[model samples]
Target: MTSLQVKDLDSGYGRIQILSGVSLEAKAGAVTCVFGPNGCGKSTLLRAIAGAVDTWSGSVRLGDQDLTGLPSHRVLQHGVTLMPQGGGVFPGLSTKENLLMGVYLLHDRAQRRHAVEQQLENFPRLRERLSTKAGQLSGGEQMMLSIARSLMLNPKFILFDEPSAGLSPKLVSEALQRVSTLAKQGVGVLMVEQNIQQALQVADYIHILANGTNRFSGTPAEIPSQKDFMQLYLGVKDSFNQDKELHHG
Candidate 1:
């Protein structure tokens, strides 16, 4: 099975370290979610895997291919694509044009046409709005187009950064459902999300990060039983103080 693996990853901007010793695996046909409070290095981890940010130490690999320190474009060539947060779409371009841009790497004219057709078929809503500018679409439709654009490359692994950000509750559910569908279609999905309940609904495995390190990792069924799960969601300081009081009592 194709999988994205990160081992002992350490990375940050300039002199600051954001992620330390981070490790996880996102396997094909499964959704692996990284959940954490803001600034906990969840997004940094995804960026490191996508080659947008440099890794100071450790390694990233896809199946047998070592991807550490590769350029973002090279990572995409190796079947890894990143769909950034807040609908990374060209607002002025027609929906069809945006989708076509994803196939820029495909040299075969026929293949590119076929890929676009497939995406339109998979997202019929997009077909109806092919001529509409991406900015004119609703939040849900814009997000759908973003995801469709990424699929045009036929990537083996996809990294999603805050996919559900800045959407209504209903839209959040719909967006996450689409992500779940990708896993069913045999794509390895690694996502960093703040929507805990919705993320858990689709995740095959969950890893929670806190203070630039892994706090907890387990299946959905196992998460609730973890003592730190609530604490991780709440503030760590409150949980620690509560624990201290109980222990001293």
Candidate 2:
């Protein structure tokens, strides 16, 4: 089982940098989570690893393979996949059709069919919605479909961006549970999620970002308390806000 590793990564859009010497490790059979204030570059870290964003410096590695600077498709070819924000499902496609599309790269008809059937077995909730359009499914259902589809490629690692974003609290719990299940099944999961408590419960390792760099990294139990984290990050934000207000005044 290979682990996804990012070492001193620096990347951003255009001339602006969102990550600065950021590094972390996501291991197979574990869920590694990135938590940060908005604009702190949690998503950029995942994008950088997947080669969806350019790495201005540093390295991305999966075992001995150097993945730095590889294009997104090439990254996928190497057994790493990403589930974009909000599941990235084709709203117009049927649930089954969307799952089938996940393995479109496999030219063998039998292989593709077998892959879809395997996902159906793992995600029985999707079995009932095979004929429904993806957009018509509930938020939780769509997330399940996305997870099932990603596994079709048999990726060693998967990146998730805001898996619980649009779901209700109950749905969010269910979705996070599903993420944990993926880890139990031996898939390395790196996720960006806003549901702090839920993520803390399920994540094997937690990394918190601030100003495009890691502010904290540890197991949930290592924290003094969630309140301490809130104060640490929010306090920085509050100081910045006061300075801004003073300048405006």
Candidate 3:
């Protein structure tokens, strides 16, 4: 089943068009990775769907609800959460405090407390850092905190923008594993990433964007098997140019 869908989406800042006629869909219990080089509009597509930027055209729907042009908070309330690239945790707050903040929408204090316990159970590292300030944690720990905070919403669909950014190789592996766990638990995930190799490894489907538009998209196995995959985003031309210059020298 399709958990999220965007059709003919055109969005950008002011008059600058970043995504033109872009379309994609994420299935329930699956991870769809959007891979691209810098300036390819990967992050813009995510912001547009998250309602951070206004959609100039096309439609976005989460499950059966139409989300086009909705406010970010309203869209969030509809069970579509966008987790952008960064350590979104509050540095000044204690680890437990940050997790509790995630459930502020839940008015009942008792419920929020229970939710904190549940989050701790899911993130053992968080349990150890409950009293520590978020700023004191390592990059991987911060990333885990950000993810655990999002899960507090118990969302139906999540848009993750480079969740593996600024992490060690081992952390990247763990982060991707966590994403896979989210998928298996039936949460729909759409991830935008620059960690192409690792992202492709976890992705059920891969969408490659170039110069503000989708250039190629297919299952990981299908696209990586072709030259276009590397040429499209990996700067194959630059590599070849460097090699040629060296050979001539």
Candidate 4:
């Protein structure tokens, strides 16, 4: 089943069009990574989907709900969550309090409690630092908290913008692992990522965006095979097939 869909999405800042006729879909229980160079409107598209920006024209559907032009909170009500590029957290609050705030939309106290317990099970490190102030946590811990907190709502789809930004190699691996696990648990993940290799390693499908439009989209195997796109978008000098043939022979 399709978890989220965007059609002919045209949006941008006032008087400046950043995305023109952008369209894509995130399938249920799959990881779709949108890869692109800088200034390619990657973050802009994410903002448009999350309802942080008004769409000039288009339709955003989460399941059957039309999320176009809805406020961020209302979008969340549709079971779609976005964790923007930066780690969004309350600096003054304890880690546990920050996680609790993520469940604000849940009106049932019992359900919220159950979700919190489940979250601790999913992210044990968070449980260990439950009483620590969010600001005091390391960058990786903050990133984990940011992702863990969002799970409190049990969202159907989550948008991740540069989830690997500002992290060590170990943390990057951990972040990607968590995202992969989320997809396995039936949460659709649409990620805007700069780490092409790592993203491709975990992604079920990949979309390459350039000049505010979708340049190409396919499985990871199709990416490094397209020489022109490799040189143009990702700047790969040689195709993966050539390397594979040499190693095999």
Candidate 5:
């Protein structure tokens, strides 16, 4: 099965350590959500998997290939892509132009054209604003463009860093739905998100990271049973109780 696996990973910036012995697996046809409070090294973990940060020790493997230590471009060629937070798009470029940049690795003109067409189909909203500058789009639209750009490559696994950040409640729901659809389409999705309720709704499995290491990992169904876990690691009252109050009140 296609999967992204990280084993005992330790990585950080120069002289400072952020992630320590962190490990998780993102499987094909499943959405894995990483939850953490601020500064818990969630983004750092994704960056380490994307090969944007240095790994002091550990292995990142996709299927049978060892991806550790490879540069970002090399990692992309291996069917892994990272859609960073804050809608990483060239503001001055048109929506179509920004998507075309995603398939730069495709040398053949016909193939590149086909990739863009497929993305346009997947994101019909972008088709209407194909010529609009990315900066001119709304926050939700920009997020769609960022995700559509990544989909242009048709990667086997996607590392999304806070896809719902800064979006309105309506847009957040839509964004999470799109992510869930990607996993159904057989793309392994590893997302770091602070939207706890939304993340639980769509995630097949959840991993809670604290102090740069995994503190809890379980299926969504199991989360409600762990009240102390929710209180201690997540720093919240019982999630189940909260849900119950919201429903009954």
Candidate 6:
């Protein structure tokens, strides 16, 4: 029943204000998606939550924990993992090496071994490529490796910044399906996505942002297709026209 909460958040680069009063909640066992056009501070929101970016105002809470103002490493230690954009696996590192990197915080050798074994069990595909350079793996496999690496900490909540970027259409579907599966496994997921079509498929709850502020928060089906920005950023153009025709009929 734990949840990640952001309330009355405000942050920006230097004097340039990006996010203003943004707020939302992402609960365990569910997928909460944030969709917005470019430069809307979606990535900044994730960075702030991960403590990668400093927050000028507001707080980030995980259940009872106050995570705001902590450093990035500290946030990860608290079970909030940020999977930044770009296939995050180290290109020159072997698959096993990348996984080992994930457990750098662990002091116990046995514990690190156990974590690696558990992730291999969770992502069997990686086990088969243990000796291969991470860069040599296919894009899909690279993504899996990144997820496995993030899971080495056994995070309660994983923040994804555009997980589907640079993926093929088919891989996008598969990747998003994997994201949904993670939620079902009881991990809270906060995704900042640009692919409206794929995002709509997996989002249990959705938040729309415009100019770095929350514009809407509801279930996917509750989205207002008629809204001008909905059609533009949401890629749901003219669906409202059909709904309007039905209403007239």
lDDT of 2: 0.85
Candidate 6 achieves a global lDDT of 0.86
Q: All candidates: CA RMSD in angstroms?
A: 5.1, 6.5, 7.0, 5.6, 5.8, 5.3
For 1-249, candidate 6 gives per-residue lDDT tens digits of: 999999889999899999998888889999999988899899999999999889999999999999989999999999999898965889999999999999999999999999999999999999999999999999999999988898998999999998898898988898899999999999999998888888888999877776787766667776455364466344343433322211100
Give the TM-score of each candidate: 0.91, 0.91, 0.90, 0.89, 0.91, 0.91
- What is the C-alpha local distance difference test score of each model? 0.86, 0.85, 0.82, 0.83, 0.86, 0.86
Tell me the lDDT of candidate 4: 0.83
Mark the regions of model 5 whose C-alpha exceeds 4 Å error after superposition: 224-226, 232-249
Residue pair clashes in candidate 1: none
Worst 10 residues of 6 by lDDT: 240-249
lDDT digits (tens) for residues 1-249 of candidate 4: 756888889988989998988778788799999887898899999889988999899899988889999998998888888897767889899998999889988889898889889889978988999999999999888998999888888889999999999889888988998899999999999999888878888998776666787666667766444465465364243423322211100
Could you tell me the lDDT of residue 155 within candidate 6? Answer: 97
Per-residue error for 19 in candidate 5, Å, reads 0.6
lDDT of 2 by residue, 1-249 (tens): 678888889999999989988877888899989888999998888888888999999999998999999999899889899888888999999999999888878899999989999999998989999999999998889989998998998999999999998889999999999999989989899999999888888999877778897666666666676566774455365332212211100
Which is the better candidate, 2 or 3, if ranked by lDDT? 2
Off by over 4 Å in 6: 226-249
Instruction: Give me the runs in candidate 3 sitting further than 4 Å from their true place.
Output: 224-226, 234-249
List the candidate 4 regions with Cα displacement exceeding 4 Å. Answer: 224-226, 232-249
1 versus 3: better TM-score goes to: 1
